[model samples]
Target: MTSTDTSDTSVLDDPVGESLRGRHAPLGRTLGRAAAYAQDVATFSAVPADPTAADWSDLARLLGPGAFADMFSCPALPPAGWEPVFVLEGRQMVWPDGGRPDPEPAATGPDVTELGKADVPEMLDLVALTRPGPFRPRTRELGTYLGVREGGRLVAMAGERLRPAGWTEISAVCVVPELRGRGHAGRLIGALVTRVLARGERPFLHVAEANTKAIALYERLGFASRKEVTFRGYTTP
Candidate 1:
């Protein structure tokens, strides 16, 4: 097996590469390489491969349906009521070169800032403003969350999730409907990406296949989709 120099922290210093590192690190070296290679092959079809269906099935059984449905569908196949059981997607790992220009810092609003643990109640309320699925009040414990507050009411927020060793997945990004189109989302992403870089980790994220607008935004932020993987599962009764 090829060895990765885990001690090499260069990738974690650049904003782009740092984000990828956070997402890739926690999976550990071996599993991270395996997952990346599998995604590459599955997407390009240059190599013939059949990943074990059981693996997906097991994850589906574990994560349940509501969460799974956001990513994929089982296509009316098997077990009569089989739902999407897993979510999978691919990202092109980006490394910053000297020639790459740094993104201009986002303009901040008076109310936008890093969130504190004391803000948990309001944070849940802000998350409710967006209606992301299966979010529990306690989900705040998952990772660092940042938010924008208006007169002390949490209005917009985004944060990290699904942390692997060197990589962290950016999830739970949203702003109130009334606040949309004001570049709040971009600012939140920029700030969160900055935090991820400071931690010596890389950042990555997943989006629904059909969300063209979100995909476009990520691309503008220097993320490129490298492969596609289906997330399959069903809702629990």
Candidate 2:
């Protein structure tokens, strides 16, 4: 299952009605005239009163020359002629029912290791093998990441991403093909949820709407779908 997330409580039909237009948008990273990642951990999810020439220009400027971004927006994004690559309708799911910590599951495989910068090579290898999601070299700098290893090789892992005011997203969850059915992903998610709850925040995630298997697993783990989102990656011209 691929773990990830993008965007707000619910986007507004009127972008200027008080959400995206304000200096203090719900998203900490979004700034004046646009809300986007300065670090480019993920795409710039924005809400312009309308996708005007200037609005798109602001998005492009924030992204920089020829840089790409995966923009998550609501139903009506006017065609801005940005280069398109990957696009999908996704679900923003939140753990409204809270964490279900399994005491034994935390140590399911070999002891879970708190991964750090030194472990990025193995982490990137695992991510490449599993296709979890976009994990840049600096992505690890954001927050806590934990993994399970067997015989000195990373087998499974999970981590955090896209934090809004009161919610932290659990992302990059995957287990190597040879290590499936060992409950590794579940254990990692449980651990992440516990940490988020400890910090007085809720856990949330995003996944493709068609990813029924992962969605079912999350539903069983107390996550409820909050909104349908269109996650789009564009190569800025």
Clashes of each: 36, 1
| Candidate 2 lDDT score at position 101 | 51
**Tens digits of lDDT, candidate 2, 91-160:** 8888764455544433455787799989988988998999978777666655689998889989999998
* Tens-digit lDDT track of model 1 for 1-237: 113333343332232223224443332112211121112111110000222455335434433453322322122232335443555443323323211224535555645577777887776776677764334554455467778777767778888655545555577788889877677777777777777666665566767766677788777876666445454434432
lDDT of 1: 0.50
* Candidate number achieving the greatest TM-score relative to the actual structure: 2
Q: Quote each prediction's TM-score.
A: 0.60, 0.79
For each candidate, the alpha-carbon lDDT, in order, equals 0.50, 0.68
TM-score for candidate 1, please give it. Answer: 0.60
